[model samples]
Target: MFTGLIETIGTIENYDDSKDGVVITITDCSPILEDVHLGDSISTNGVCLTVIEFDEQRTKFKVGVAPETLRKTNLGNLTTTSNVNLERAVTSDVRLGGHVVQGHVDTIATIVDKKPDGEAISYTFELRDKEFINYIVHKGFIAIDGTSLTITSVDDSKAQFSIMLISYSQSKVILAQKKIGDTVNIEVDLTGKLIEKQIESNLRQQMNNEESQLNKLISSIVERKVKELMK
Candidate 1:
């Protein structure tokens, strides 16, 4: 799990594609690779990827992504010079500064607009996938491109929030690279998703049972009226 607090921004040195899958090599300022092994997992642009290789001197790590992951995320559009968000997995000793982020991006969203709202900046993003909006709530926590944020306002298809970004966050987090028309990977709060699904399932089941009872009552009423008319 991740706290949605971005630790560093990684530069995509190279992206190689083959019939099997895509391999991405990224360089980060975080000494994340110092102890990183070949099988370690890293959050890249909000998507969890396994480290296939790394070099100590370059502070670089390589990860292989399947076609499905590339299709679901903006990784497919990444090139050699693309900037990607980077965050290492949470350890037991670290404080949970932000909300829980699984680094499993549900889908990608596009930036609609951004403007200066005093010192903090308020940005709006258009929800591309219809199902993604169901889990979003006003004042809820969300991770956009690996930066955890609280949703100040949210609608059926849009989310807006003003982020109080510090100098370190602005420089190291992916928020600095945002543009008006850029696409970003989105991951909703895993806890919220589970709770919403449970509520929906219960509501649907209750509605179905109520409908059955209503139909039976209506049928009984009609039968009684027919008997009365016959008499």
Candidate 2:
């Protein structure tokens, strides 16, 4: 698991695609690669990739991207010289500066707009799949390109949400350098999705005995959860 905190930005040195799968070599990551191992997992652009090979100097590392990951994330769009957000798995002793992130990409979103907001910059992203908008809430946590950020607002009409990056964060992560039409991998709050799944399962089990009561119960639970998140 990860805390969704980006440690550094690593440039894609090489992107080799073959009939077997995709292997990417990332350079300029000597800091985090110091204690790395062969099987260690690194959060690359918010998608967990296992370290398959590394050089003795530790300046660069290689990881293989699965087909499923390529289909679900923006990693497939990356090429040589692309910069990606990088974070190592959190240790038990470290403080979780960001929310829990599984390094699992839920979906990819496009940067629809970006504008200056005081010393900070605000970005608005439109989800490629509208169905996932249900997981997005105002003030809720969302990890974009492995950087944890709070949702400033949500627009159901456009299937979009906004986030603000302080000046300090802008210098630290790769998201600030992206263009308006560029796509970024997104991972929503895990807690919210878990809660929704549990409630949904419970409602489904009670559907046979009391359909009307189950519907009311599900509605009440959803409404209460929404209120709690908004607060």
Candidate 3:
């Protein structure tokens, strides 16, 4: 798992598209690659990718993205010069700076508005997959391009939400590079998803139990009526 805190930004060096999938080579990601191995996982633009290869100098690494992942995220639109948020998987020893981020992007969202909010910047995004809004709540945690942010406001009907980024976050991550209409990978809070699943499961089980009891009651009543008629 990952914490939505971005470590640094990495520049895309090359994008190789094949029948299998796309292979992305990024350079200048030394910070994340400091203790990296061949199988280490890295969050690239909020997508969890395994390290397929890395340079001896630890300046660059290559990750292969499957077609399904490309379709779900904005990674397919990345170019050679595109800068992406980079984060290494959190270790058991480090403090959880940000909320739990699995790096499993659910959908892509489009930036509808960007404005200055005092020293911070506020961005409003419209989700492409509106169904995911069910799990998003105002003041809840959301990961945009792997940066964990709290939702300032949410328009549930319209499937849009706004988030404010402090000056430090804007300067440290690649959010500054984004503009209106640009798409970003989105990962809603994991806790919310788990809660929703549990609630749904409980509701289904309760409904089934109620239905079974009603059936039993009807059968007992019908049997009594038959006995009275026979008598």
Candidate 4:
């Protein structure tokens, strides 16, 4: 689990393909040798990756990306110098900033438009594949490329949102590197997913209860008719 608070803008230093998977090296602006170790989970571009090795002193870290993760995230397209949002897994005592992020990519959304809205920047991204859009809700929270943002508007296949880029968000994350046509990974809020599940579960329970009641009523009527016929 993660807090969605980006620690720094990490750049891809190197990537090598091997038979099993790809080994990735990343460099970031965070404090040197900040105690990150092997097996630590890092949120890279809204996707979770495990650290296979680290050279914190040299400001370098490495992760082994499985092919399955590559298929679900934009990490596969990474090359040397690709900047990404970086965040480590939260500790027990850290403040719960942002929202709960599983670092799981739901689907890919394309940026159709970007413009300024008041003091913030409004981005319009088209939601392709109805299955992905079904999870989107207006004013709800979403994490795109590991940066948590709120939805401002919604259409059949498009979503619009204005995000205020405070100084911290601008400096700590990779917003400086964002371009119009670039594709980023997306992760929906865990709260929204759970609420969706609850709704479905409640509806199924109600239907089952109604069916049981209907069956009992029919049995009662049958017994009453049998008594009347015997009389």
54-151 per-residue lDDT for model 3 (tens digits): 99999999999999999999999999999999999999897788899999999999999999989999999999999999889989999999999999
- TM-score for each model: 0.83, 0.90, 0.91, 0.82
Against the reference, the lDDT scores of all candidates come to 0.79, 0.93, 0.93, 0.75
Model 3: pairs clashing at backbone N, Cα or C within 3 Å:
none
Where does candidate 4 stray beyond 4 Å? 29-33, 56-58, 157-168, 208-231
Error of 1 at 229 (Å): 16
**Tens-digit lDDT track of model 4 for 42-154:** 88888888888877364878888888888777778899998888888888997977888888888666666666555555666654344666666777778888888777776
Q: After TM-score superposition, what is the CA distance of residue 196 in candidate 1 from its true location, in Å?
A: 2.4
Candidate 1 differs from the real structure by a C-alpha RMSD in angstroms, to one decimal, of: 4.3
Candidates 1 and 3 compared: the better one by TM-score is: 3
Put down candidate 2 lDDT per residue, 155-215, tens digits, no spaces.
Answer: 9989999999999999999988998999999998998889999999887778756557877
Q: How close to the true structure is residue 150 of candidate 2, measured as C-alpha lDDT?
A: 99
Worst 10-residue stretch by lDDT in candidate 3? Answer: 206-215
lDDT tens digits, residue span 140-221, model 1? 8888887888887776734433334544466767766688888888888787778888988986766678566656687789
- Pairs that collide in candidate 1 are none
Task: Show model 3 residue runs off by greater than 4 Å.
Answer: 211-231
Count clashes in each candidate, considering only residues at least 3 apart in sequence or on different chains: 0, 0, 0, 0
Residue 63 Cα positional deviation in candidate 3, in Å, after optimal superposition: 0.3
Model 3 deviation from the true structure expressed as Cα RMSD, one decimal place:
5.1
